[model samples]
Target: MAQPYRPDDRSECVLAFEALEGALRCLKDDIARTERRCQEVRRAYRQLIEVAASDAELPRVEPDSRLYRLTH
Candidate 1:
């Protein structure tokens, strides 16, 4: 069973709603940033694939090196 909300609880409810709204905004910002980074990685992968397909001399970059860091 649940208790009914009353007028006295209105302020608390409003405060909670505001807090939730702020958190949602932050989440949206984080999602946008992640999307941009994913796009960069995808572009880099495509470039590498194209180079590999053409039987060209591959750049001697280490797999675990920072050579693939895509600049914005």
Candidate 2:
């Protein structure tokens, strides 16, 4: 009977290679999700600033916010 050709450390090498591939796939998915969330935040901010522009008497920032600076 004939036997299969195998490396001296075939089992360890195969498992390590599989683990590395899985980690790379997970990292790619995370990057895509993060980019989408960033786009959503940017759009909401643009809409808020546009609405704030209509009030001429306003200083473009809320009185309770950090833009209302204290004198140093």
Candidate 3:
């Protein structure tokens, strides 16, 4: 079972706020790094798909069509 909530003293409350701010800053940095990595992965996947689409065995798609945009 969880303990009942208790209010902190003034100094403790200030420390808690500092810790929370530090954690949020770290989280923002982590999110930015992950987003960049995801973009790289997406670009690599698109390149592979383009190569597969160019193969003679596959049917060709119209460049101007929505289907082409969806696949690539």
TM-scores for every predicted model: 0.62, 0.62, 0.64
* Model 3 vs truth, CA RMSD: 4.9
- Using TM-score, give the best candidate's number: 3
Q: What would you estimate as the lDDT of candidate 1?
A: 0.70
- Ranking the candidates on TM-score from highest down gives 3, 2, 1
In candidate 2, stretches whose alpha carbon ends up further than 4 angstroms from where it belongs are 1-8, 61-72
Error of 2 at 1 (Å): 42
Residues 1-72, candidate 2, lDDT per residue (tens digit)? Answer: 223435577886787677778888999999999988877766776666667678787557665765333211
Clashing residue pairs, candidate 1? none
> For residues 1-72, what per-residue lDDT tens digits would candidate 3 score against the true structure?
322333557766676777778889999999999999978877876776688778989776678976567445
lDDT of 1 by residue, 1-72 (tens): 323446478887777677778889999999999999889887987687567757757655455656444421
Q: For model 3, how many clashes?
A: 0
lDDT of each: 0.70, 0.66, 0.74
